[model samples]
Target: MSDHLPVLKVRLFGGFSASYGEIPVSFGRNTTTKAMKLLQILLYHGDTGISRDKLLDELYGREELADAANNLRVTAHRLKKIIVDAGLPSHNYINIKKGIYRWDAPMPTEVDAHQFVILSKDVQACTDKVKKLALLKKICLMYSGEFLPELSGDEWVLVESVHYKNIYSESLQELCKLLIERGDYEEALRFCEPACQLYPFDEWQSVRIDCYMALNRYKDAVQEYENTAKLFFEELGIRPSEHMMQQFEQMSSRLNYKPQELGDIKERLKDDDVRGGAFYCSLPSFRDSYRLVSRIIERNGQSVYLMLCSITNGKGMPMDKPDKLEALSGELLNTIQQCLRKGDSFTKYSPSQFLILLVGTNKENCSMIFDRIQRYFSREHKSWKQYLDYFVSSVAEVDRQDSPIQFNTENKTW
Candidate 1:
């Protein structure tokens, strides 16, 4: 058996990185280059060894290279130099026996993705529950993020990433179940919270909520549920899944029955005293207020309008840079707050956009409100200039109960 790379621990999850014991091995500045990609593919395939033809397809996908095989040879040659040049004692590095290319180093390498698979299989075979639980926890920890996330868009990386992620999700779920069954909810969170941050949209948030509920952390459970629901709405434009809703349903019942004094409850529910200007809120709160207003307008015969405000570069382009958007967003926020009244409410929809709810305002009045915002933006935000786009929707007309509201999108740039 060949000796392994001396304490070489390769990390393919989250990002591609390697360490020889405590010292790091650099893959150079640009990880997306073809040479690095060749290295990654060979390392991922490991002992199974990717066939030469398969490597060709993965390396160059249908761009009509004149000599594709020759190109791959050059890439592999460069990869060898990079590995040796990065201070690793070199051997052949990439070995091909009868056209099956493998990572042929002097010694074996400990890759996180491979180690995760090995441990997961061990967990499955483990008869002792305690040992199995420990293995499962290690499996969850090993998958810090998706495999080669920076290269996730590539076809080979995408397939492998998905496979790694599926294993991670299943392993984490199993670990949490074991912990919850054993009444070790705190220990479960030590694994689940990091997973939540890495895969927020993947329903690991549900696992976190489960941990919170198991520990009798009713408030934390409710807060996590609400935050997860809002994240789903804002980012995915979808509601939480049925399973997630079921989890929240269990927590919601707990949320309602809290023992508290009536005075204390009132104090908790009370908002800060009126400070004038539009009541700025989060997108979720804006959604709630918008729904409440829609219901009330039918009975009160009052006009309500929904306006979308967007900040953009001139010539109808978007201002997307972080530094520029921060300055422009702040200026636009100030302009909207200063121009709108106390009755109106606005929420930031994104860094470059806001949703404004103008109550008791007609079509013409909506225009007038926008005019005020535009004038203020032009005057105060002159040095930091950005164009504004505002779209107004009449709430009554939108909710008229005449037919389903097929929104005539009123997007306009001011």
Candidate 2:
């Protein structure tokens, strides 16, 4: 215990577990149930210490809080003893003083929820294309399962549970956008399936359909729409929105038009290789634009590059109101296209951001193109520019050892 670093990892977004290095640390087998509750409270507050009264409220609700106080104290003592016996020092993980408990160590532990937040922040801060893509990959790895799958009846846990679930869902959506931008429809579909399953909400299903359409899997897209409609009707007793139905209609119309052969598609993708690399970006606004941009990019024979940028004004733009955000997005797309070569592509990665695929160009050229477009948009839409500073522009070259693309904006090279 003395040789090992003192630390406890709290993961509330997914499963709950505490470990010291390679060995698993437990709060006594007998106290497992009580310890789980206590840990949940601590995780909800992050690194802050939780008072005993707060723990009582979280555990017993409005019922007899006094009756459980002694029992909780006993459980806490047992939990401490278990950790001590497991070769963990007394001060290594949990700290108890004046009936307050908090994690007091520094080592990183595998807590899925904490990992989710950290990875998400990393993805948001990352400005280099290769690093952003790598971060997105890590984000997917951290989201192994639903939050607190083992706990169900506890109302307190449910609150934190749903919060993380939404974070996981949003992270998946961002990952899908990145993969789709790279022109990797198959990979995008892989990411979207889980999201659609967990969050059968129309948005996730809609994204899944977009991925199917990008792969030119029109039948699958149509089937997805039908299945989604059924789920919506059964679960919410509501029909799919007109916007969603319109997408289905579009895909239905394309059913009779045969797409390019697989071999042709591959050759076309290869020819449009921009920088021989890939990156991830965010576009919370252009959920529908993702599919459209994928089709446009593939049709024009271009590789996709991603730069995940977050948009703060996500809820401000209503998808149904084309006169507002949609029209603005169209204008931005047109502006971006005008600044790029004939083979380039652009798609909304998140509500406030977009990913640009500049074919026949490397990282340097991509930055210049994006800068020009950014400048143009800034001058044209002063309000948008004020709200959304071109947060980040990361560029990665494709096929360069197939490793993650790293960007050096100062040097303007990948």
Best by TM-score: 1
Candidate 1, residues 54-129, lDDT tens digits: the string is: 8998889736899999999899888898999998886778888999999877765888888888998898789999
C-alpha lDDT score of every prediction, in listed order: 0.75, 0.56
Candidate 2 lDDT over residue span 110-221, tens digit each: 4566667888888778888778877887777667666665654344453455556656667677777777888888877777776665556425778778878878888989
Backbone collisions counted per model: 3, 21
Best by lDDT, which number?
Answer: 1
Score residue 355 of candidate 2 by CA lDDT: 60
Model 1 segments beyond 4 Å from truth?
A: 1-5, 246-253, 257-414
How does each model score on TM-score? 0.60, 0.53
